[model samples]
Target: MFDSVLVAVFTYNEENKISEVLEKMCKKFKNILVVDNNSQDNTLKRISNYPVKCIHHKYNLGKSNSMKTALDYARINNFEYLAFIDGDGQHSISDLEKICNKILDIKNGLVIGFREDLTNLNLKKRIGTKILNKIFTLLYKKKISDIQCGLRVFNISEKSIKWESSGLQHYFADAEITCNAIKNGCQISQIPIQTITSDKFKGMNILQGLYLLIMIVVWRVF
Candidate 1:
């Protein structure tokens, strides 16, 4: 684990996956932060056993808000670098070592993951991702293979990283964050990441996926 790195995770009803994620995370990141979005299950209890710093939310504040909570906590606590991953068992802990090592070198930049494949992605998510990739490449003149990958590392300084989590309606938090970072002269690098697809997904459907796409297009055009 890197003493200079603090890893954060956003969780909601992730009781089944949080333990495994933490076990792996401890291998590369000494400090772990869990921001629970008011899970209705045993997620909080399960994560309580770990040495992680837990931040409980009474309500579901969405991913961007939860992530923002992690960032703010990291900044205030004096963490030099802040990295976050999904709580849905999609990120690989081994890849974190490489990403972190590289990011530490570029103290004031961003390091994001580029997925190797969408083996775990459902039909709607796969289609939406492809469309967003095209749009990002066109608009930003940068080839971003995975605009939604949860694995990313960035500096903790307020001036170095500015997040507008208020734009939660866009549902493209990763893309927007990266776009803003690049626009403000922060260097960005993409490292390859492995995908862990899930067999079951609750509440998310094709319609919600479509809404996300429309929102992204609207946000970009305007």
Candidate 2:
């Protein structure tokens, strides 16, 4: 096991699934941080029983803000590594064990989890991801299969490497941040990971996906 690592989960009304996610993460990482965006449900109460560090935001601050809070916590606590995962139980916790060693080897790069399956995902999401892969390749000259995957590992000491995006920009923050880190002389690698399709999670609903696409176009143009 590594010396110190913090696993962060961004939650917004994920009461139905947060408990399992937290339990799995706590088993491996020990220090789990939950950044709740004022969830109305018992997500907070359910998570309270676990030894998790809770950062409550009175309003919905978007995913990037949640991530920013996670980074801040990691940096402040002197945690060597920061791992990001979904609070909706889509990512397999066992994958963490398999990739931890590989991540440690990279040392100065971001370790991204590339999901094994995409055929079950929504067609629009698949198309959007394909477009993003093409755009990232053209812009950053890198081949990344799972650019938007939530399961990723990074070293907090490499803060200067990536940009903490804001607003709807968070939808593509994973790609942007990784590219930014690459441009800043940091290496990035992909590791094979398992994925689950859970309808209960409810992230980036159909409407939000459309909105995010519009934002991407606007951002890309100027």
The candidate that achieves the highest lDDT relative to the unseen native structure: 1
Candidate number of the best TM-score: 1
lDDT of candidate 2 over 1-222, digit per residue (tens): 456778888888989899888877777777788999889999999999898899999988888888888988989999888888878888888877655666778776688888767776778766766776666566656677776778888878885445556776665566556666656767777888876788853556566655555544454454
Per-candidate local distance difference test: 0.77, 0.75
Q: Model 2, poorest ten-residue lDDT window? A: 213-222
Whole-model lDDT, candidate 2? 0.75
CA lDDT for candidate 1: 0.77
Backbone steric clashes in candidate 1, count: 1
Kindly provide the TM-score of model 2 when superposed on the true structure, using C-alpha atoms.
0.87
